[model samples]
Target: MPTPTEIRLKRAERLLEVAFDDGSRFRLPAEYLRVESPSAEVQGHGPGQKVLVSGRREVGILRLEPVGHYAIRIAFDDLHDSGIYSWDYLHRLGTEQAERWAAYEQALAEKGLSRDPPRRRGG
Candidate 1:
């Protein structure tokens, strides 16, 4: 398992860049992280109780609060400030981004949901 050495938020790109001591780097999109948060509100108290969060297409990072040396708390512009994103958790999320995103997309598809609003061209 890789340990994070530093974390930087690129506000303009809406991405969180994490550098691990093992020379690994992950650039996670803010929207992705916000939707996949590990908070109880999203994960619930059991295995099959995870909530599918929608309407996060416009969510942005409001703040990143360090929790000692192990974790950091992310505050979203949508008022989701409960999830404490630990280094290990963040690493896992980064590592599993593709698979997780696929699953999320699949779930959304099954539920007739979309990640973003429809785009209008030349408007």
Candidate 2:
């Protein structure tokens, strides 16, 4: 069980860099994190209640507000600041990003949604 030693938000790059004590670092995109937020507004109270977040394809982090030493609250450009991202949760996200992303994609496919807008093909 590795623990996060530091978490830094690169607002300019729209990424969150999390470094663990075990010398591993992960850079998570703001849009991905926003869509995968654990807040009730997004995740709801239990399984099968996740709200598909749209219009966040261009969303970015405006700022990172530290909540003491336990967590960091991310303020997004889309005005979603309700979720408090904890260090442990962030670490878990970093570790499970691949699986979580795949799951999100599957869910989106089932619902006929996409992370980004469809591109127009040449005639």
TM-score winner: 1
Which tens-of-lDDT digit does each residue in 15-96 have in candidate 1? 8999998887999998899888989999999999999987677778989999998899999888899999988899999889
Per-residue CA lDDT of model 2 for 1-123, tens digit only, reads 666787777877889999988888999999889998878899899988989885567789988888887778888888899888877888889889999888878888888887774666998
* lDDT value for model 1: 0.89
Residue pairs of candidate 1 with colliding backbone atoms: none
lDDT for each candidate structure: 0.89, 0.84
User: Least accurate stretch of 10 residues (summed lDDT) in model 1?
Assistant: 114-123
Runs in model 1 lying further than 4 Å from the true structure: 117-123
**Residue pairs in steric clash, candidate 2?**
none
After superposition, the stretches of candidate 2 with alpha carbons farther than 4 Å from their true spots are 1-3, 117-123
For candidate 2, give the lDDT of residue 21.
87
